[model samples]
Structures are given as C-alpha cells and as structure tokens.
Target: MILETGVVVAVESDGLWVETIQKSACEVCVAEKGCGQKFLSKLAGKTVSIRVLRNKRSSEEFTVGQSVTIGIPEDIIVMASLLVYLLPIFTAIGGAWLFSDSDWQAVGGAFGGLLLGGLLVNLHSVRKRDDVRFNPVLMEEQIQPNILNFQH
Candidate 1:
C-alpha cells in the first residue's frame, strides 16, 4: 500500500477529509526549470481532498493545514478482521465436527483447521490484489466540453 501524507480539510462523524498532495508527473518531461503545468498546479494548489477512515485513538497530529499520513483504501481493516475472527471461528467449528472423537480433540481440530484456512485465505487475497493494490481516490470534477464546434 502507498502511504501518503495529506492535510485534514474537514472532519466528519465517521471519517476525515484530507487534501493530499499530488505531484504533477508533468515534471518528468519538462525541459525548463518550471513548466506551465507545474505553474498551474501551484496556482491551483497541488492537493486533492480525500475521505479517510477514522478510529477511536484519533491522532491529533493532523490539523486543518497540518500534514499527516493516512492509510488509503482502509479495507485491510475489514479483511484482517475476517481472517482473524470469522475464519478461525468457522474453521474451528468445521474442524471439530470433521475430527470429532471427544470434546478436547474436537477443540484442537477446530483450531488447526482455522490456522490452515486463515493462512490460505490471506495468501490468496495478497496474491489477488498484488497488481491493483488498494488506494484512496479523490473525487473527480465533472466538466462539459464545447460541443458546438462541428464541421459540416
């Protein structure tokens, strides 16, 4: 995951609004010290507002203008929870039933099954998202082009 720094622009009940700095890639091809794109970005500001998840330990490091590194996508939290809790619990029950001889043996079987399932699931998820990793995207502005320019 790409860890990014942004400024807190707004605070919502469940999340936070952050204006992240997006460096212009135009700099890569620019010949001069500064290009028109850079100038425009600077003029318009190199920031994009993005909504981020909030938690109880809400770090006070971020202020309206202060910079902070917030995690993007935020789905890892959910995925981890599923793997940690649901996977284990489900595996335990299933494993116990599959290898049921006594109560203690069933309990041990359940834990073992959960371990295998959790590991396999996590590995699969990691491989799946390897190319398209999770990241926060900014809201796009809608623009209408001049459609009157038609050649007959």
Candidate 2:
C-alpha cells in the first residue's frame, strides 16, 4: 500500500474532503538528475482534494485542518500505469503488424490503433470513475496538539 498525508478540509454526508499538495518524488530519487518527472510535476498543478469515505472515521473526531494519512493499494497504481502507458503502444504495434503488406497502410493502421486505444482508455475511465477500488482509504488521523499557556 502507498500512503499519503493530507489535511481534512471538509466533512460531508458521504465522505471527508482531504486536501494534499502535489509533491514530487524526484527530490529524493537517485535519478533526479536524469529524469524529467520533476519538470512534469512542476507543470502539473498543485493542491489535490480527495474524497475519503466516512466508513473509517467519524465526523465528530475527524475535524477540518486535522492531518490524515490515506493509502492506495500498490496493485491499483501498477494496473493504472500499464493501462495508461502500455495499452496504446501495444495497440499500435498490433495494427502495424496487421497491415504490414504496405508501408503506407501500416503507418495509417498504427495511427488508427493509437486513436482507438486512447478512446478505450477514456471510456474505461468514465466507467470506473466511481469504483471504490480506485478510491483511497483513510488509514490514520492526527489531531493537532493543544498549546500550553504559561502563568503570568
């Protein structure tokens, strides 16, 4: 399971809105000097708000501004990466192989397959948007410590 820390922003009937910053892993990665993830993450906008189900925590205790740790299964992340990255490449290769009789035909087929793959990805996303398996779960909550006042 992968964990992320976020702050509870609001309490709703169905879930709690937890807000998190878009932090890049490149900072601590050994390949930071050679990788483009840091640049891409910078271009990607910050401040993501996720709706965490209330099944794990109660509104009475999980108040706004309280820090919470959420977790997503590693398998989910791996599957998503494959679907997003490998699907299109495989589809294009298949199309090219199918139309290998002529160079022009193969090129056209590859482009068509890429488009089809992208459409499939979009359809899958729409269909699975509300899937509970894709949603992150609240693992732990942290309440801020109260400050002590000194006697005058």
Candidate 3:
C-alpha cells in the first residue's frame, strides 16, 4: 500500500476532504550541480486537497484539523498508470505503422488512434467509477506531532 498523511479539512456524509502539502527532494536539494527540477517544483503548487471516500466499516471519526492516513494498493496504481499513460502512446504507434503507406495517412491514423485510446480510457473510467478497488481508502487515524512541513 502507498500511504499518505493528510489533515482532514472538511467532512461529508460520504467522504472527507484531506489537505496535504506536496513535497519533493528537489525542493530541498541544495546541490549546485543538480538538475532544474527544483525550479519546476517551485513552479508547481505546494498544497493539494483530495476527497477520500469513507469506508462504512470504519468507526466514527473526529472533526477537522485532525490527521489521517490514506492508502491505495500498489498493483492498482501500476495498472492505472499503464492504462492512463501508455495506452495512447502504444495505440498511436501502432496506427502510424499500420497506415505507413503515406505520410499524411500515417499522421491521420495516429491522431485517430489517439482519440480512440482516449475514448477507451473514458469508457473504462466510467465503467469502473463505482468500483472500490480504484478509490483511495482511508486508513487508521494518525496522531503525531504537529510539525509543519514547509520546504519553500
């Protein structure tokens, strides 16, 4: 399981809104010889909030400003990454190769295949929208020191 610690910002009947501070090694890497990832990380936002679906089996919880752990299965993440990121790329290459008789045809085929891949992704998401396997599950209540994590 990939676990993340976040503070509950809001609570709803069916879910909780958790806020997390996004951090990366790039933000703290002071090595002068390092790449430009530090600059990129600075350009990106620092705080993110995500809604976590509540588990019915979970006991009644606390109020806002409380920290909690959320987790998702590693296999689900791997499969989702492949489907969301690689499917279009592979399909586009295949379409171009299959229509390689002419340059224009190949380009058109690639674009068409990309669109088809996107549609397939959309369909899959809709079909599995209600599946609990794809959603992040709320783990145990986390009570730790109130140490603020600011890497700015």
Per-model root-mean-square deviation over C-alphas:
16.3, 5.5, 6.0
Q: Per-model C-alpha lDDT, please?
A: 0.60, 0.76, 0.74
Q: For model 1, how does the per-residue alpha-carbon lDDT over 1-152 read when each residue is reduced to its tens digit?
A: 44566666776654567777666345356553655766677788867786665544353433455445665455765665676678767877889998899988997898898887788777866665423343343222211122343236
TM-score of each: 0.37, 0.64, 0.69
Q: Give the per-residue lDDT digits (tens) of candidate 2, residues 1-152.
A: 87778888898866789887756355578988788767766777467898776545467766677777777788988998999998888889888889889999999989988988898888988787657687677775434422332225
**lDDT over C-alpha atoms for residue 71 of model 3:** 76
- Which number leads on lDDT? 2
Q: How accurate is candidate 3 locally (lDDT)?
A: 0.74
Error of 3 at 13 (Å): 4.8
lDDT, model 2, position 81: 90
> In model 2, which regions exceed 4 Å deviation?
7-19, 32-67, 140-152
Candidate 3 ranges with C-alpha deviation above 4 Å: 9-13, 24-45, 57-65, 141-152
**Model 2 TM-score relative to the real fold:** 0.64
